[model samples]
Target chain A: MSFKPDHEIYRRRFSRNLGVGLCLVAFVMLGFFLTVEKVTRGNPLDALQGKPYVAAPVAP
Target chain B: MTDIQAQATPAEPGFGDFVQLLKPRVMSLVVFTALVGLMVAPVHLYPVAGFSAILFIALGAGASGALNMWWDADIDAVMRRTRNRPVPSGRIQPCEALGLGVALSGISVVMLALATNLMAAGLLAFTIFFYAVVYSMWLKRLTPQNIVIGGAAGAFPPMIGWVAATGSMSLEACLMFALIFMWTPPHFWALALFMKEDYSNAGVPMLTVTHGRRATRVHVLVYTLLLVPFAMALGWMSIGGPVYIAAAAVLNVWFVVGAVRIWRRDEVQAEADKYAVEKAFFRFSLVYLFAHFSALLVEAVLRAQVYGV
Candidate 1:
């Protein structure tokens, strides 16, 4: 059992969006993966041990 | 944050409730496929890295479940099948589920990024987002096509595993993704067919609730038709071999025949045995998915030992 489409309108949107979302999501996924790989691969604990993504506030 | 924490103090949740929050059955499938994905990839993972990667992925899956339970508690309370879940049973508060889910999501993603490549971590992130936000929050309540789109969340673990091993996606990885994505509709719909009253009671607008059983039966046949080729095709891809192809052929023949029987059932025939065909088909759906993925793993092992691939 599944959804009853209100009409063919969602049917069309569903089909189109599945394709669009697949590609968009895949692209972002790959981009994020590569970026993280570049930043983190050398050391598992680097985030903990090294400088943060943002600099700590300077002492007054 | 303080207000939410305040609510958790009044009720003590046992260890089992926390375990239940993870939805272990679903996690096991995630672990299985992700392991297969990693093992079959051209590049292998270190034992420790592999273990860690899988741990994080399972956590990600658990995170999605927690978030889903948190969000769906209202409708869940209405469905007999889901009414006893931790949140609705009052074993844990919604805020606790939400907090646990969000915390696990961040921890799993960050740790996976550390343990594997960015790609695997990113895929895990998308998977959680897809299940929690896209599937749970939006598509589920709004469409009868909910499972169709939401199935993608379940489909990502294998690909994430492959990425973990190779630090990149490949044809084999995509095929694994396609295999699960294609398999989800029929699998879930089969359950929906038998559990129609639960959907009706819960006001969930499932296919049986909206389209009626006849249409759902036909849809099962049609989707099963679509699924077979995609499944068999993987036999010819980098991941495929004689063993996998042979297993796929046998499994799919049974699957299609079952779907056809389901499609052929009329109200009279179905009611005679209380949806026996539908129920049988639902049972087969589980075997159908597990068999295919297991076949892939078997082929990989065979090749490793025999063919030296």
Candidate 2:
């Protein structure tokens, strides 16, 4: 049996799948940035290296 | 000839249907007020943090919207205004909305804690619970003063934003909360005056349905009168500036005049005018909120730019 590329089901489901896919991608990016912000600002790694993690003074 | 294709196609839910489950218009208000709240706080947040904080709060608000749809599906189906919502119209399953609300509520609260602070997260969690359970399930069906109390749920975002930024509460944040809380009654009562039939048909005890339109109109004026002090006080607070005070003065005058007009009209006169005054008041209430918040935001920007606060 041959599969049709433009089936009705495919057309119906495409947008929903694409939206969920985009949201997941965006969430991953948000997580990456959040981690980077936390680590860079406080230098949490300093604590792991036997040093205190002093929070950087935040800008107004 | 194409028997398989001729079979009736079940109505399939789409992305937009799911988004509708989130009540995007309400989410817009949530996003705007929360942004203003975050901006006006004394401490500045890193751009990414600020964005994430607002996004999570919006998500929490949207999650509650979904839960409200789930709970209110019956009343929603009866009400003309909400009859076509995703769940009530059968595009999305009630269980799906429930699951989405629960999952997003958990995710938003946890992510907010991670992105901002525990206080902000706690407030978001409480807000979701207040909206979904206390307001939607209990207060909405039980009392004419439903939105009056339920307005607290919508009033929370700015306080959450403030807490997210300052990691604590202040009078400024409370003032912003009070402004929205006070504004909600008149805003909704105006809508209720026009949409009385929907609330009556849905068996919801809106003030217009229970206390008569005349009483609802009086309540609108009284609430509008009460709301003015909160708005003016916020203007005089540290966050308030010349811009905000001026805006508040003008907006309050217009708002009070609108409320008084609403109060003075009898149903016969209102019907003669096709409820024009009520509809105008409803539209202006949206502007009243947006302008007030915008003024606060403008003051924050000016302070940051000029005084470098």
Candidate 3:
């Protein structure tokens, strides 16, 4: 019901880990976007307008 | 009846508690491998779809983690390493974790299927099941080989990522999976070696507890040795390059050396050192896997530029 001292410590560690994870996610996203932009040679936002919306093909 | 009724009264879950349920440290490894898999696969999805697929896979990983936290709450409460987990810490109720896990598992699988291919979605579903059921409920308590076998669940992300891109598993993907799978035992065993007392105290059937530290150390060395070829093989695959090969060679050797140090240490020395070997091995093992995968990623980028992959 209430947080203990160990709980506080875990929370701190969790927060720090979460920050690291978010930084990684950001780094990956930036890299992905930059790669996409480089490959397309066009603005990614502009490309999004014509983006195909195909449904997932069923597994065989 | 009275104690059962008391225990059945569910506690409320706050926002932070929900986040804690995900086992975010484990999720980071899953996310990294899955990202690499999607990145280097020959087939490409729209960037938007690719990110979405990875996100869903991450959610699926989190869901499985939540389920594991729920199922293992009892044991986790007893174990020093896990006692602070959300469910065990009373920050969240077990049933709530179960419900959240189920909901997110369905959402992730279905969303991943929609965002990418059914193959990736299917793999996500299976990973969740393997972790929640096979590893957590069955293997963990049943066998000393728990992490040895259970480690497979953690090893599937890259393969799933590759499938998300290519719509099928490939030789390269299998090699990537093998690298992680082989690395798991030693990585985990190193932790177990230091935490043998904790495992014994908690009554968990860890290899260190059941077979003794000498045996566990030997197994750790063996698995670390096995990981060398698998890591190197990834460098030989089409996805690999010279840089990757060089990196894997060095990292694997370093890893094996760490394992060997742990194996050769006498109990008196090990006790005098007090977690030194275990700590170094555990920390370096993390660096080792990251180096291998990062090298692969670097190779993929270099090849894409030089040879158009």
What is the per-residue lDDT of model 1 for residues A10-59, given as tens digits with 9 covering 90 to 100?
Answer: 55456546654774595466456545544554343566676464446999
Cα displacement (angstroms), candidate 2, residue B148, comes to 0.1
Recovered native contacts, candidate 3: 0.00
Summarize candidate 1's per-residue lDDT along B41-110 as a digit string, tens digits.
Answer: 8888756578778888999999999999999999889999889999998878999999989999998899
lDDT of 2 by residue, B196-235 (tens): 8899999999998888988999999999999999999998
Candidate 3 TM-score, C-alpha based: 0.83
Best by TM-score: 2
**TM-score-sorted candidate list, best first:** 2, 3, 1
Candidates sorted on DockQ, descending: 2, 3, 1
lDDT of each: 0.86, 0.94, 0.85
Q: Which runs of model 1 end up more than 4 angstroms from their true locations? A: A1-60, B1-10
Cα lDDT for residue B246, candidate 1: 90
- iRMSD value for model 3: 6.5
Over the stretch B11-111, how does candidate 3's per-residue lDDT look in tens digits?
A: 44445678789888888999999999988888887766777778888889999999999998999999888898888888677898999899999988987
Candidate 1, residue B166: how far the Cα is off, in Å: 0.7
